[model samples]
Each structure stands twice: as structure tokens, then as C-alpha cells.
Target: MISVLFAVLTAISNGSASVLQRRAASTVPDAEAMHLSLIRHLLRKKVWLAGIGLVVVAAVCQAVALATGPIAVVQPIFVIELPATLLIASCAFRVRLSRSAWRGVASVTCGLALGMAAAAPGGGSESVPGYRWIPALIVTGVFEAALIIWSRRLRGNARAALLGLAAACGYALTAALMKDAVSRLDNGGGVLALVSAWQLYGMAVAGVGALFLLQNALQAGSLVASQPMLTLGDALISITYGVTLFGESLRSGWWLLPELIGVALIAAGCVELARSPLMTGAKPPPPRVR
Candidate 1:
């Protein structure tokens, strides 16, 4: 039950964060400028600052959720927020959602629901171990560095989506490492020891970098496209790590039949949603108080 609560909180935070980020992105004029300059300008703006603050809160909530639940459980719930975000963005900011976008949202939601239902029932009780995070941190750092270099040569929405995807990957890796660290802790001493280690700081840096790239993605494209892609990508990565690396369990072989059907339904929904015309040409709407 606690895990369920955490998942719900994660969903709410994630949904709200996307909306806020999208609102911030809509404020920047579509023009050519250095990415750094754009970030500075957007951050300095009052609207952007408020939007970022929301994202920060969402991040904190996500951390709390990670501390409480298995990544497989929490991450899937969080991904469902992509559709929730679209609905909120449309209603709050008057952004129109094309039929396809709505279908996509429905599809993602259904898939996630099935996935969550099929997840193993045990709550995680183990704390993360120290020293296990070093390799993961190194891998995430390398990936981020590559993204930074590659991002320089790209432009427009494509660039933004790529950046967002990179950011999501970083976040997914960080989540995996953080889960490992938390699951291995024996006491306050262990937690404190891990906190004092350089790896902890490295994780923090990766998280910040993810946010930076995600914001850049929002700046370059419609939220409808960038948000769903990033969320789905992140969820997929986290689920993969959770199951393959962390030994988190899915339902037993007996349930595989229903699970397959659920997955098929979800895939179909995603296709229908992605094909919606509203997402392809939609512009970010102006920010408004909700």
C-alpha cells in the first residue's frame, strides 16, 4: 500500500512537472541562440523560474518514491504521467490535443496499468550497498558527455527530442544506481557513508544534467512530442534495469498470457496516439495560472 501511494505521488509530480516545463518553454521565442544563453534567458524569466521550481519539487517527490518502492513499480506509474500531462496542458493552457494524441495517452495509460498489475507483489526491504554505484555513475557520465557533444550539431525539434531522450537515459541510470545504494544500506552509518562518498555527488551531477537537457528539449519542440517520448524512454530503461539487474520480478509464467495481450493493446494505442496530427504541428501554448 505504501508503494502504491508512492507511485501515485510520482505520477502527480511527473504530470505537473511536464506541464510546468512546457509552459516555460512556450515563453521563449523560436529563434536561433546558444543553448546556454537560451537556458539562462529562460531561467531568468519569472515564468520559467516558477516552472523550474515545480520540476524541482517533482524531482524531490521522485527521490522519495524511489526510496520507498521498487523502480519497476514506481517508474511505470511515473511514465503514465505523460498522458496526464497532455490533458493538464490542454485544459490549463488551452493547448489543443489532436485525436491521435488522445489515443496515444489512452494507449500508454492502458499499457502501464497492465504492466503495473503484472509486477511482482513484494515491497523492497533492502538498502542500497556502497561502492556498487561507481560503474553506473561512470557509464551515465560517459553517456551525458556524448549527448552534449552530439547535441551541438543538431537543430530544432529533432535536437530537442534527442536531448530529452538522453536526459531520460541519464535519469534512468541514476535511478538504478540510487536504488542499489539505498537497498544496501545497513544503518544510518551506511547511509551517511554513502552520502559522503564522491559517487553520491556524481549522481547529483547526473541528475542536474538530465534536467538541463530535458529543459532544452522542451524549448525546442512541442511538449506533446517531447514529454511522452522522454517519459516512455525513461520508463523502458528503468524497467529493463530493474528486472535484469536488480532482480525485480514480474508475474510468474502463468500470467504471461494476459501480460502479452496487455502489451499488444498498449502498443496499438501508442501507435494510434503517435499518428495523431495534433502532435506533429502543435505549438506550445502561452503560460497561464492554474
Candidate 2:
């Protein structure tokens, strides 16, 4: 129950964070790149700062949740952010919600709910030792860097999608490492004393890098394109890590059928949502009066 509560809080935080970042990114004109590089310079405004703050808070919540909950239980719950962001967009940003957008949100919500219910509770034990996480973090960082460079060669929507996917992978691996670190801290005494010095630094670096790339991806393309891509991809990667590395389990044979259906619904909804005109054609309204 505590795990479920943490998951829901994390999802809401993440969902709002994405919406805020997207709202900030939308303020920059797409034509600014073609018109003048200096015009693009104005993109470095306070909006991004606010968005970054929200994201940082979300990451902190997520780290705490991972520390306390089983991976399988927590990972699927994060998917709720997709629908939650839509709600934020409607209420906070005054973005018009189209029929297709609402449908997509519903599909994703239902799917994620089903997935979460299908997942079983676990002991949240340390599967991988604290020291082992250092090497894993380094390897994941290198891979994420390679993916970012590779994404640069692609163009338009393809590039944005690839970058979002890469960011998701980076985030998933970071979550896994954080979980290991948190478990290690539970061991007490000198172990926590020794690990605290460098582990926190490493986590901060990884978390910031992932957030930056995710923001870049959102800035580069439509929120519809980037959000669902990142959300769904991140969910899949997290689930993979949960099952393979953390030893999370499905409830029973009956659960597998719904789990498959849920994933399918999520994927289909994300695809539809990503291609929606509301997202692809979204533009900032005129600046409000003070």
C-alpha cells in the first residue's frame, strides 16, 4: 500500500514536470532556428529553469519511491504520468483537449491501472551490491552518450523519437542503480558511511544528464511525439529491469494475459496520442498581459 501511494505520487510529479517543460518549450518558435541563431538564443529563459525545478523534485520523489518499493510495483505506476500530463495540459496550460487525445489518455490510464494491479509485491531486497552499481552506471552512461550522438544524424520526428527513447533508457538504468544504492544503505554502519560520499554524487550526475536530454528531446519536437515515446519506452525499460534484475514477479498465469493486453493498449494509445494534431501542431498562444 505504501508502495502504491509512492508510485502514484511519483507519477503525478513526473506528469506535471513534463507538462511544465513542454509548456516552456512551446514558447520558442520553431522558425527561430531558420530565422536567426540569435533568435534561438532567447530560448534560454526562466521557463526552462522552472521546468528543471519541477523535474528535479520529481526525480527526488522517484528516488525515494525506488528506495522504499519493489521495482515492478513502482515502475508500472509511473506510466500514469501520461494521462496525468494530459490533465495538467488541459487545466494548467489551457490546451484544448481533442477527442482523440482524451481517448488516448483513457486507454493509457486503463492499461497502466491494469498493469499495476497485475504486479505483485516483493521484499525490495538488494539484488545487486552497491559496489557493482559503479560499473553499471559507467557503462550505461557511455551507451546513453552514444545514443545521443547517433540520434543527431536523424532528422525531424525520427530524431526526437530516438532521443526520447535514449533518455528513457538512461532514466530506467538510473532508477535501477538508485534502487541498489538505497538497498545498500539499509545494511547500516560503515557501509553507508563509505558509500554515501560518492554514490550520491554519481546519482546526481546521472539524474541531471537524463533530465537534460529529456528536455532537449521535448524542445526538439512536439510534446505528443516526445512525451509518449519517453513515457512508454521508459516504462518498458523499467519493467525489464524490474523483472530481470530486481526479481519482481507477475501475479499468476491469468495476469500475463492482461499484462500483454495492457502493454498493447498502452503502445497503441501512445502511438495514436503521439500522432495527434493537438500535439504535432501545438503552438504557444500570445503572451499574456501583466
Candidate 3:
């Protein structure tokens, strides 16, 4: 399907972007964590700019995927971004990954396939009702605010995880708003309606906010700490938005078992990958042979 294909493209672009952005963000001072100075610092780094370019490409692909497919289906495919990031990092840094890293990647791949197949998400309204958006926005705003506030008190990986999850929620909100805005064009409202839609502007704001939060997440700690939260959190939160806000359906009853197993596999895979030196840009131990 076009949506799935585009979603995969989106994941690749995003994965590459994340690695570049992290490299740039790591140079900034820890005191600059969530400050505007962080953005200013990153703006000077060519690597960050390159990452931004990839982000734009991912955004275009994401827009196409969301327009052509259900948010539940499109967003979950991003689970591959972590593995892609690790692999890209491996290539970029010329670090060899251990066998366990490959196993983690395979586990994530199989888990996503199983989870998506089991959930089989389908049947959602393209346009959510305005009233429904009211509560959704309020709840999301509160949740993100709490996360940011809580993150300020933590350090290292903990801070990165919190900010990453917050950014994930923001990205999910952006996708939801993007889908709603684009529905104007789908419904034959043409360019005028699309431009005038509030969702369009909201999506822009949410996207920028999400980008800012993601920068802080990268600056907070190693990719090992931030990537899993960003990857898994986005998928889970987007699925919630799809189900609650867009009325998307997922299989239930017997399907719950596979879904749980898939989630476990994904979580375990993330943990394994998180332990890799590649994630932290640290040199791996020497390979021993018989």
C-alpha cells in the first residue's frame, strides 16, 4: 500500500535525522537543555541543519501517509526508526555492532509486524468532530506540561526519557491535526478550505513545539535513553489518538494476547539495543576470538 510504503520512507528519513540531530545536540552545554539557546546553538551546526532537511522530507512523507491511510497504521510503522538510527549510527561512526544489537533489531522488526497484524487497525473518520478535539487538546496539553515540569527536576537518562515521551505526544498531536486539516482537501473543499483550517495552523505550532522538545531530549543524554521513549512513546500515543479522537478500530478479545507479546518483544528489544555502545557513541570492547 502507498501509505505503508511512504510510512517506511518516513521512518528512514526520521532515523537519519535523529542520529544527525543527536550529534549536534550533544555539543551544547547541559545548562542549555530546554532553553532557546539550545536551538540557537543547534542552528549553527551544519549537521543539525542536515537533520532538519531530513525532517522536512519525513514530514512530507508522513503527510502523504496520513492522507492515504489510518493514523494507527501509519504512525506505528515508525517503530523501525530506532533500529534505523542505530544502523545508521553504526555506519556513520564505523563502529561494528555486536550480535545482540542485530538480534534487537530483528526482534523489533518482528514485534512490529506481529503487533500491527494483530491489531489490524482500521475504520476511522477522516475528520474528527470539533467538540471531540476540545477535550483531546486539553488533556494532551496538561500531560505534556506535566512531563516538562517533571523533567526539569531530573538529570541524565531520566530527563531524556521524560522529554522524549513529551515530544512523542506532541508529534502525535501534530499528526492528528495534520490528518484533520488535510481532510478538507479530501472532502473536496479545495485549497481555500485547507488554508483556512485551524487544524493546519495548530499542526504547525505543535510540530515546532515537538521539534523543540526533541532537541532537548537529545541534549539530555545518550540516544540509548531517548530513542526508545521517542520511538515507542510516539507509536503508543498516536494509537491512542487514533482510537479515541479519530474513532479508529483495533481487533480485540483473542488478539490481545499477540498484542501484549508484541509489545513485550518491542520493549525487550529496546532494552537490549539501549545497552549497546553504539547508542552512546562509545567505543566497543575488542572482539575476542578462539
Q: Which number leads on TM-score?
A: 3
Structure candidate 3, residue pairs in collision: none
Consecutive 10-residue window with the lowest summed lDDT within model 3: 274-283
In candidate 2, what are the lDDT values of residues 44-133, reduced to their tens digit?
Answer: 766556656767677777767887787766777787776665566567666667677788888987887777666554654555655656
Q: Using Cα atoms with residue i matched to residue i, what is each candidate's TM-score against the true structure?
A: 0.75, 0.78, 0.94
Q: Give a tens-digit lDDT track for model 3, residues 168-205.
A: 99999999999999999999999999999999999999
Residue 236 in model 3: lDDT: 91
Q: Could you arrange the candidates by TM-score from highest to lowest?
A: 3, 2, 1
lDDT of each: 0.65, 0.68, 0.91
- Candidates 1 and 3 compared: the better one by TM-score is 3
Return model 1's CA RMSD, one decimal. 5.2
Candidate 2, residue 247: Cα displacement in angstroms equals: 2.7
lDDT (tens digit, per residue) of candidate 1 on 23-101: 6665676573335667876766776676667666766677667767788777767765556555665686566776567
Instruction: TM-score winner between 2 and 3, please give it.
Output: 3
Query: What total of clashing residue pairs does each candidate reach?
Result: 12, 0, 0
lDDT of 2 at 66: 82
Location of the lowest summed lDDT over 10 successive residues in candidate 2: 33-42
